[model samples]
Target chain A: MIPVLRAAVNTLVHVPDLVRYGSKPFREGSRPGSFLADLKARLRTFEDAAAYPPHQAFIGNLRPESLADIPSPWYGHPLPGASHQGPFGEILGQGPFYSMLEKADQFGLVSLDAGWTPPANGASAAAKGLMSAGARRGTEKEIRRRIGSGEALALEHEGALIGCIRRDHEEDESLAARVLLENLAAKASGAHALRLLLEKARLPAEEVDYILSCSEEAIGDRYNRGGGNLAKAIGEMAGCPNAAGTDIKAFCAAPVYALVHAAALVQAGVVRNAVVVGGGSLAKLGMKSHRHIEKRMPVLEDVLGGVAFWVGPDDGESPRLNLEMAGRHPSGRPSTPQGMMEALVCEPLARAGRKLREIDKYAVELHNPEVTLPAGAGDVPLTNYRTLAALAVIRGEIGREEIPAFIRDHGMPGFAPTQGHIPAGVPYLGHALAAMRAGTMKSAMVVAKGSLFLGRMTQQADGASIVVES
Target chain B: MDLDNQATIKQLVDAHGAENLVVVLGMSGEGVRIAAETLTTGDPSWAGPLAGVSLGLPVYHILEERVRTRLPAEIYAEKVQLMEMVLDVAQIEDALAGLRKTQAKRS
Candidate 1:
């Protein structure tokens, strides 16, 4: 059964504006040995990131808020423009995200009112049902602490404390408010993307049978650290009023894995449509910026990237996910780089009776090179493409002399950010669909890999792939 | 799965004889202490396969002596002690090599 690409949406949040206030180090009593502390030091060393050319260019690739309008860069150069807004979603500034958090949080709801305030701003109930009860006025001391400590972004009406987030949790180490705040921002963005996708596909939210959150944030208190139903929560928030939800985790490969699972479900006739959604990670906010700053480059790791896509029954008009051709990095496979590509790329194509050259495009880790190169990781996509070409020659599919030309034909530059789980190769689906629908391309291969050792589970690498055909 | 040290110990003693070779699982606190005592030096560095066993799926093979194996609770206190026991994976491998050599010689 053909797995249809019904809809796709990508969203990003520019966190530089919100970093000081929302990020951990700038918080009142920030802890040591945290990512935030490292980030804080990095920020102090590199005052501004917007001033860098590569940073601006990085922003240029993200102009179309809608993945539909965005040109898939795998064909040629990336889409042009520095604008961060699109019809489906935009790179949200922190102020609105904080308001979104207030709206999403029931315990510490924020209320902003324009009542008698000049150019009004305050955290007021963005949604009434979630914050049905009128917000209690915060004490001057409490308001001062929230703003001063960077625990909450202050809501001011003519410089008056109109509203702020409540410190509902007792411990600083495990603040439910911050976790919920970050999660709600994702939910709001995902909800927005899902709405746009439903509209794009002309399908109602209720029609979606399942929702899978492939995001990497673990939201829970100390007692139930990783206990989660974030899938259900994100879906419910996205207005999937009747869908069941669950989270899929394999680190960077989650989104694609979710797509594979959705295809299987649709093919099995268990569900007509499923949405795989992932929100960006706040923890990964300034993760690699230390290297970026030290090298005198823009901290291109500024945006919180997110995407949601629909896996539905095939219609002749859409590109189909070749589920049977999907690859799995099985147990006992060697964890070497050569072993990895053999497991994820070559072996899968062999099983599907296809050749490596048959794939017009390969979307591996499309991390924007400007971000990685400065940090000394090199161009990730180019590396993968070169490896693939080398492997093709070794496998006797092509001669060693064809390696360079093979790379030129198959590889597209990587345009994704360092959002740990966001760029594990689904970004190309939008472009692949457009190209296939336009009859410009025949097939695109999406490859994703994950490090299983981070969990202390195993040292072996993990990978899975799915081919989409026109 | 819970580790049954008593059965494993009994099996090891039956196969290689107590003086020749001893097996320690480090399942319980006592088991870990006894295993550490047996080593008398060095540390139970859980570098490779042993690390997988501690935090991930357990790998088991039926020895010349048959004994069922069980793992400890996911977050038991004894786990750290067990992981820290003196049975370094390489050393354990050497013991297996010794057994292989012994079998070849006998043959």
Candidate 2:
């Protein structure tokens, strides 16, 4: 049998306070004459979490199917049900997130106060979740000494002291406290998803033979800017003692790229179970805060998203990953939207002996409209669906008159955060798995595109797609 | 914006001058702000040839009321109807309005 996607896990780390630390915002706000105070004043408090609709949809507390009926612009219209735990995984809060940072730390760099304790609500249970996830806390210490000596950065929530992350090197700016916080956040969130993957797959940690990290963080010294093995570090944190790992980078397309690679490894019998995971991006938190503030809405990008997929040999029942139907965009192809749709969608369907109308769903760039619309980014997923609909019209699969209905039926609203790789195609896997199990959908395609030009390396766009069938 | 695009815009301005060119952008949201700023105040990103060269050109997003009202209804319906339906037009207009106001103050 060919490789199949056995299980998938999605997690969100609520780090509202950490929004100020996002790479773009932090870098700009730290400069002279920046409006740092105004930004801080606009950030939403944790008490507002219960009323946030997107937050509810993220943790599986609210079904994605229900979101279609919730009316457009889901910000002010808060959904009733709210929970930290979802069917896929939990939305770990700030206190537990801090605990995770310490848990990911190997060199005693993160120091939580001996008397410090997790909050008494959902986060209290998360402390136990961390332990079950195989996160270990070494010798706790009073972090005050290092903080007083200016060798550590205090981790604060709602203006209260929580813990601190110690600087790795006295003078090396590369090991500065801020950089460590970003790195630790990625590892912790990735570990959280890995743990969920093991639980969802009903496999022991040791059974995971290989780990692939497609996270967007660059974890290395200045001498070797992007050199990395974050995958191994995340596996260690998640207690995958036998899992050797490596990192893959393709910008937003990395997750799909990694998924294809995982399928190959499992099909080739190189690894019994290959896990592809991407951690939450701290730098992406509050990515659209300026627009959210202007619109008088909560910063919807406050949560950091993490996802993991367990790929193994086909179990006949699970959704088979049709590698033969995989699509790739060649460098010579035009990077226009229509060109992309042709390369990633049309060509793949043609080769797979399928029709455009046969695809039950298409998960494209899933950036949440709530976070994007206020900033004039428009509805990203809706635009992609429209493009697909137009392509269908041109192919005579659907008439121009059927475009609106076709788009509405084939695609759901964008619900993933704007954390680059986090929103790129894979977020719909958990929902697709459930739909396939219920027989509501027989076939779907996961597609993603990357802006390679963002790195200033090349103007070429990167993209890949794979068909999933029940 | 790329330097080549900015260089082309610069040549166009030099040939026809800034006053005659009312830059109209079909971009949505923050994209309108970036392109408008590039025309009116100069390239804010500074990666292009328009850096520090204030063209002070009047700019409008195709979704804005000013430009939408001017276009023939049938042509507008055919060309931009779908994009307008999906974009947050009011927010995009407001962003351009604010930028234009800021540029006016600077001039």
Candidate 3:
């Protein structure tokens, strides 16, 4: 048994963020255009997102009224205490995130608070720098002055620039401040959630034996592209220097992959404690918001989402990750939605000799509906749960008539933001643990799925699952 | 988008190299058709790069069947490339062997 001691989720949005970043100017040539005007005109206001039900849910501030009235196509209103600090994690706006990147690495941060200190060795960056996406165009001296300036410019005509992060050599564009800031934000956010888990477990930060960072950040200089050490870098920032770590990438399935690895390590007595953590994605911010704003719905997808948990030696107390019976979609399996559920749900239950009703809950891609619904992706979590129920009926584990009751009893409304990797099977963990402890629930199936073709590596859609018992 | 199933199957088979399939399956054309039929029954929603393997078994099974093909089996099985055809000597020899056996029995 591997216990998930604590879980945390955080949200952040830079309004002139992904939308501005993905515009033409950032890609090749620097010809500024009217894109910024269009963005500013229709961008989601902080108040609008702050009052959105899904945002409140991501930060763990969702009201019972909102949770109970789950099936309504409309989100009635924001919870009363939506502004309160989340029980799970904090919801930070971009201004604070800019400062967080600075605070994440004070030494790398320019003392001016807003700007970055330029690399002392101008020759290296000049020689080695290839203009990567978001690469800063400046001389070493110009960069140095920008760093030293008290009011260092954090924004240009379009996007926000959170000071530069440096590499071993001042000259590598691969370690450009832009890339470094992205990496640091991921690291800081992962550490933020890690620290929350540490507090929850009452365990010393240093006591963690290993850290597995499963975030979507791919940090690189021009030469390596995505040559990475993200997990180790995050471990350093999260105050777990003693813990050895590495990254595990499977797109949205990464956290579950990390969980399996962590559980294996703990269960095998290789480590006493291991933590799996992931930060939100900036690339995904405003990803689905154009549809929302167009439909007159709040751009509920405005916030980034994150989650972290400790996989420790089970105490015979906490909710248990049942490693013996895990479900996996073989690389040969079909990649349809029904195929995913069959491989990840029914097969695992078959292996365990348990019926569908025996499992109390199913947590599969919990992307909040407020965001996905308007975007035509539909209610992802509800769809996944209902798919599980449908599969159960097909397997004759339950009658078709029982499907409605099964959903009402076992399915949780989607609350996680569609932060690509974070939304997979992790959001309900906080609630699942509480339910298990309260004796209202016995076990759950945590399923994580991914589109493998995104990497162009394989045609197969990837998935994995594990039974978590009370 | 090109739903002409037979042409699509031929294109896929050619792209994937049926020389290996001819050697592996014994019944070359039948195996090709089976593989193609499995591929073209693709999910209408997913017309992306994964169209072939998305709904089918893992690419591994298509490459390596339930029976393992060993290293030494390729030593004598050679093929001539005449643009569209990979004429394998092994497949040719197998057919000749069957023809000879039947002819000798008739005689």
Candidate 3 accuracy as TM-score: 0.69
As for candidate 2, its clashing pairs are A376-B29
Most DockQ-accurate candidate: 2
Best by lDDT: 2
DockQ of each: 0.02, 0.24, 0.02
Ranking according to lDDT, highest score first: 2, 1, 3
Q: Please report, in order, the local distance difference test score of every candidate based on alpha carbons.
A: 0.60, 0.80, 0.60
Name the runs in model 2 displaced over 4 angstroms: A32-34, A45-47, A120-150, A170-173, B1-8, B11-26, B29-107
Candidate 1 per-residue lDDT over residues A167-253, each given as its tens digit: 446574455445655666566555555655666567887888999888887656677666666788777765678899788888898
Better of 1 and 3 by TM-score: 3
| Model 3 chain A poorest 10 in a row by lDDT | A122-131
**What are the candidates' C-alpha RMSDs?**
13.0, 5.2, 14.3
RMSD of 1: 13.0
Give Cα distance to truth, residue A103, candidate 2, Å. Answer: 1.4
| lDDT tens digits, residue span A1-470, model 2 | 49998988888877877887887678778688664566677765554554466666665566565788888667657766566667776677677787778767878787766566756346423234553232343233556677888998777777666678888888777778888888888989998888887876787888899999999888887686678889999998888999998998999999988998999888888988899999989888877787677677766777888999999898889998888888889999977677788899999899867888899999899888878877777788988898888778767788778988988778888888899998898888888888899989888899999999988989888899988889
Error of 1 at A157 (Å): 14
**Predictions in order: chain A TM-score:** 0.80, 0.93, 0.82
Write the number of the candidate with greater TM-score, choosing between 1 and 2. Answer: 2
